[model samples]
Target: MITFGFITIHPNQENTYITEIARHSDSNTIVYRFIPTAIDPATEKVHGEKFNHESGVWETAVFDIPMYLYDRCFYGDDPLSIRSQPIMNWLKNRPYSTFIGLGLPNKWEIYNVLRSDEELAAYTPKTIKASSVPKIINKLIKDKKLLLKPKNGSQGKGIIGLMVTKGKVEALTHKNQKLITKSFLSKSEFSKWLDQLLSSRDYMCQQLLPLQDVDNHPFDIRILLQKNENGEWIEQGRGIRRGLKDHLISNINAGAEVLKYDDWVNALPVQQQALLTDGITTIINKVPKLLEREFLNLFELGIDIGFGIDGGVWILDINSKPGRKVILHSKEGKADELYKAPLQYSAYLEKQSLVKGVD
Candidate 1:
C-alpha cells in the first residue's frame, strides 16, 4: 500500500477517482487519498475538511500516510499560497515524494535549460526572434502576416499575430481575435507597441506558418508525453485541434476542436505525414534529454506542433503543466487512460527512487 498525497486545486486530481481503477488495472499497487472530512464513528477519520478561509489552504485533520504526492492545486485562492514553503521542506524529510503539475523546487532553472528557440527550431519549423519585431515585420511585408509570442507562455495565451496591409500593421490574437490596428504607419508606433509587448513578457517574433484547415479552420497537434511505469517517456496521446475559421492558432482552450491524431495525419499526403512525424519526433527526442540535463526533474510535457500552408511543421509551444480538459472530454476515453499513467508513474518513482532514511 502506497500513500499518495495531493496538494492541488481539486481533490479528484489526488487521483482518488483513478486510483481504484488503476488498482484493478495495475494489480501490484494500492493507492488512497488523504481525505480531510468528518470522522466516522467506527474509523475515527475526518471527512469534509474545512478550507482555511483566511489562509486559503485546505487543512487535513490527520497527518496520514502517503509515500507519494502530487501537486494539482492551482485553482481557487491557491492552496500553495500558505502551505508551499513548509510543505516543500517537509517533503525533503519524507521518505519519498513526487509531484504531477508544475512548481517543484527548481522548476524555473529546469525551464531555462530546455527553453531555446534555435534548439527547438532544429526539430520543427519555428521562427525565433530575428533581431527585433520591427525588423522581422519589415521583412515579412511581402507575406502580410506574422506571429509574435512570448517565449514562455501556455494555453495559446499571449500570442499576437500581425497583418501588414499596404504598409499598415494590425495586431490580433492567434485566434484572429483583433487586439489593435495601426500602420507600421510610423516607426514610433511600431516601436511603442514592440516595447510594450516585449517588456510585458519575453517574446519572440515568428513567421506565421500556414496551417492545414478543417472546414476552413486552421488546426495544430498537441502530443501529451509522460513517463510510463517502465520509466520511459512515451507519447500518451496525440490529438489534433482545428481552430475557428480564419484563426491561425488551434488550441482547444481557445475554441478549437480536438480530433484523433491518426485521423488527422491520414488525411494529409504521405510525404507530408512523414515530415510531420519526423519533425515532431526530432524535437521530442531532444527536448526531454535537455530538460533532464538542465532542469533536473521533469517527467512529462505537452508538445504543440503547427503545420504551415507550405507543408512545414512548426513547434508552437511546450507546456510543462498541460491541460487535460480535452482528453477528459475525448470520446474514446483513451485520453483519460493516458492522462492517468503519469499519476501512477509518479507513485512508482516515489517507491523506487526514494531510499529509506536517506536524502
Candidate 2:
C-alpha cells in the first residue's frame, strides 16, 4: 500500500479538506496528517493522526514518514512557525521523502522572475523591496499612491494602501476582518508610520492599480490550475472575487464574495468580454509553464489576475499553496474532483518512481 502524508503547522488546520481527501483516496492508499514539529528526528517517526476510512475518523498514531508528502504549512511570525522552519527544511532535504509539489519562493523573488519574462512582463507589475523608508516615501509622493504587501504574506494579510493628496496622507488596511483607515496631516507623520511598518517585517511596494469595479469594490479573477494523474497541467476552475466597497484587497479571507466567472464575464460588453477571455487564456497557458521552468516542479497554482478600470490586465498574485474556497463557492460539482486531486497525483508520482526502480 502507498502511504501519503499531509503536513501542517497546526493539527486542526484544514481538517475538513484533508478528511475529504482521505475519504476519496483509492484502495491502495492510506492517508495520515501530522504537524511538522511532531516528527521525531531521532527515530524518523511522526506522532500524528491517521484517517480510519471505515469509521471516517482520524485516530492517533505513530509511524514512519510517508514516502509522499503534501505540505500545507503556512508560516507566520509566530514562535511555532519559527521553530518549524528548520525542521521543514530538513524534511525537504531528506533523500527518502518526496513532496507532491516543491513550493515557490517569496513574493519579491516571484515578482522579479515574472517581470523578466518577455511575454509576461506587460501583465506584471513593477515591484520593489520596501527596504528603505525614504525611498518608499519618495515613491508614494511620486506615484500619489502605493500598495504595500508582506514579502511572504498570504490570505491578503499585512497589506496596506497608502495615498497622498494635498499634503495629507491616507492609509487603509484590514484588521481582524474590518477595514481600518487612518489619515496623517503631514508627510513626516506618514513617514514615521511607514518606517515602523516596514521594520516589523519584510515588505514589497508597488504603484497602486485601479483594480476596482464600477461600484468601487476591489475585485480580481482567481484561477486554480492543477496537474492531473497524467502529470499534465489543467485548469481546475476560475471565479471572480470581489471585496467590500473601497477595500484594498479581494481575498476571500478578508470577507470577499465569490462570483461565477461566466456570469461576471457575460455581464460585460461583448468586446470587453472577448478581451478578458483572451487575456485570461494567455496567462493560464503561460504562467504555469514559466514558473515550473524557473523554479521547481509544482502540482498546482492559484493565479490571481486583476482587470484595471483602464482596461488593462495585471497578474496580481500567484500562490502555490492555494485555498479552494473560490472554486467551491463559484463552481458546482467540483467537490469530488478537488478531494481526489492529491490522491490521484500521488498515485501517478508513485508509478513514475517505481518505473525508475526507486524504492
Question: Which ranges of candidate 1 are over 4 A from the true structure?
Answer: 9-66, 73-97, 100-121, 125-144, 174-185, 212-216, 328-336, 354-359
lDDT agreement of model 1 with the native: 0.59
Q: List, residue by residue over 1-359, the lDDT tens digit for candidate 2.
A: 99999999987899899999999997799899999999998898999999998898999999999989999999987988999989999999999989999999999889988898897888998889889989998898799999999998899998999998767889999987689989999767878888898888999999999999989999999999999999999999999999988899999888899999999989888888877888888889999999999999999999999998887889999999999999999999999999999889999998999889965
Best by lDDT: 2
lDDT, candidates in the order shown: 0.59, 0.92
Q: Write one digit per residue (lDDT tens) for candidate 1, span 1-359.
A: 45445444345564543443343333333334442222243543324332333453445455444455544433222554344444444554545345543333322333344456456645444355545656765756756777776665556776777887665677776434433444568757877877777766666665677675746687877777777776778876677778777765777767788887776689889988888788887877887666665544666777777777677766666766666645554436475566467556766676666656375
- In angstroms, what RMSD does candidate 1 have relative to the true structure? 7.2
Least well predicted 10-residue stretch by lDDT in candidate 1: 30-39
